[model samples]
Target chain A: MGLIQREIERAGIATIGISIVREFTEKVQPPRTVFLRWPFGHPLGEPGNSAQQRAVVLEALRALYQIEEPGTIIDLPFRWRREKYADYLPPTAADLE
Target chain B: MDVTRFKNRTLARLATRFPRLAQRFIDGYQAQESAGSIPWAVPKPLRQAKLALVTTSGIHHQRQAPFDMNDSDGDPSYRTLNGEELFDDFQITHDYYDHTDARKDPNIIFPLGPLRELVSEGLLGRLAQTHYAFMGHIDGRHIPTLVEKTAREVAAKLKADQVDLVLLTPA
Candidate 1:
């Protein structure tokens, strides 16, 4: 996704991207990005939350304005899933591997 | 298959909700998506620029052919959608993500309503003639082709439509 965003940016059209995975997006940065710690499918916020979605859209566009340099990623303060992220995270160095 | 070791219900639910992520974590591996270098494009004001959005949520017109889920490396194809299309004319076909909510409310994946409202409020530049969608699961050797070929194709389409800014929403 970041690759395609970079290609579009190279084509001379400024591009902004929203990513579910910040680590992955941070590696292959688009010209501008908004990193949201959200679910896989809902990039603009949860389903049916139009106001929050619109706010997200505004923030995404606002990211374009605030970022003067390329490859800048603005992390949105929003978060989803009240579960302990560490609990859901698979053990990196454990019996699983 | 073993739930005895995990105590958190949310964690167990997440494993079931997105099996791909769970599998990757179990394997202790994830894709290294790196373009190596950043590409810069001068941006115009949001108020008057021609804005466009591209989603990887498998949204396409009802008349168009759906994405090829049979491809192991996933589909690199993209479909064009205009603002004028009815909400009923679109559907999702990607197998990777959970689309139950998206199916219930397409705005979860595609923000046509919010975008149109932005236009109505004059909060953004005019929308371009077309928006785009591609299945998000494309990987393996097809990655480069998608980056090179399909990206150019979409960029050409955007250029022809005089789009100045593009917003990419990845599912």
Candidate 2:
């Protein structure tokens, strides 16, 4: 959670948050943020794709190094290649009723 | 083109086997979003900073205490994972997010592999001896306790370990 990140940063330790949902991360405004277009459960690419996962992590750390201003967010160019079913589905709007 | 998708913690595997449970998950998820505090602290360069990793992926070793899944509000607890431990020894107890891939390769949730590489390459300062993990489904209210208390404790541990930078991954 970005809240936790902020608390840790407040303690004088810098924090880099890698997360989904750009809007949530935007609201939290972590000192440094790396936004990924991946699904809910997987932040560093798919489950076993080590190369892609490492790339995502490296990008996050890279952002950590490059971001100088407070609340800087770097959107990762990576995409979740497979179908994401866990915790993500649109109910066609009418389903809420 | 006029669909509505919400941020949910999980669509249980049961949701697929039972189908009808998906809506409940959505309701639970939307209720979890919150307004987080903004705090900023600048640190030294990455190559000079002592690094640590924190994850909301519910990761823990079999020997450590497990997160309580029964708590609907969230476990609000934390675990310390030695960076040296084998990835095979760890397990995830979270139900909110899909763990299928995480079960196979932990980099999906905790990127210790890349972290180690970074440290060795001298791109990142040395790794902190410790790391942390907790379940990510806590509601907005229960979260402050985690942030104010548990996380502070963890940060203290990081401070004790002389860590300067933390990479937090949220699922």
Candidate 3:
């Protein structure tokens, strides 16, 4: 996934990846990433959990704008099936800027 | 199914159910590490950027041919996804992971629904009508093909679509 992401970023499109395997992400080194210690096939979060999914989307987008140095991977703090996401405040336009 | 396919599927289910087993599997595959400079693209503000998804989670339209699971080197080819109608007939092809949860709710891997909701709430700008999907287990001989051919092809397509930001998810 990081390999493909590198190509997309090289094409001048900003890229951020959600990585399940930290070892691969660290090796392939995409432009920006959010590393989650979640299970395989569950990069965003649990099935049918909209709030957790949205929180992840928000974090990736936030990392997209916030990460300046290339190849930076932010370790997300959400625990699989053990964390609550109802209070993940969506960043406003001003906050992003 | 052949012996290799059946083994891969069974192991995938085990890996998904057990992270330690997944780690052992991940450890066996030596992912190529970068040696030189990394590519960087300046990002625009989320509220004004046109976002697109690129998932290596083996998702494709049900009508489309599934990714080739026979190749142990893994399939480097990607499928073009139409955001509007993808969920109506979605299918997952890669045998590298247990997709029972993703099948129940694709947003766990694809996150398109959550992204659309963000757009609706005015937190995100707009989503590109098109996205991409690839089977993530490419290895050995297919690595060069992915780096030099198929991945570049998807990148060019994303460029043509004027996508400003991309979020990649893996299986």
Model 3 CAPRI rating: high
Candidate 3 per-residue lDDT, tens place, A32-58, comes to 999999999999889999999988988
Top-lDDT candidate index: 3
DockQ of predictions, in order shown = 0.33, 0.30, 0.89
Ten contiguous residues with the weakest lDDT in model 3 chain B: B40-49
Tens digits of per-residue lDDT for model 2 on A55-92? 67666766665777878888865655753334233222
lDDT of 3 by residue, B1-171 (tens): 999999999999999999999999988989988878899988887788899999999999999999999988989999999999999999999998999999999999999999899799887789999999999999899999999999999999999988998999998
Ranking by DockQ: 3, 1, 2
Model 2: clashing residue pairs?
A: A87-B11, B9-B96, B10-B96
Please say which candidate is ahead in TM-score: 1 or 3: 3
Worst 10 residues of 2 chain B by lDDT: B1-10
Model 2 lDDT per residue over B1-171, tens place: 111111223344544234346445544455333354456676677777788888888988988877877666888888889878849699887776667778888887888887787678767667877898978777756777887798788878888888888899987
Residue ranges of candidate 2 with Cα displaced over 4 Å: A82-97, B1-10, B13-37
Chain B, model 3, TM-score against the native?
0.98
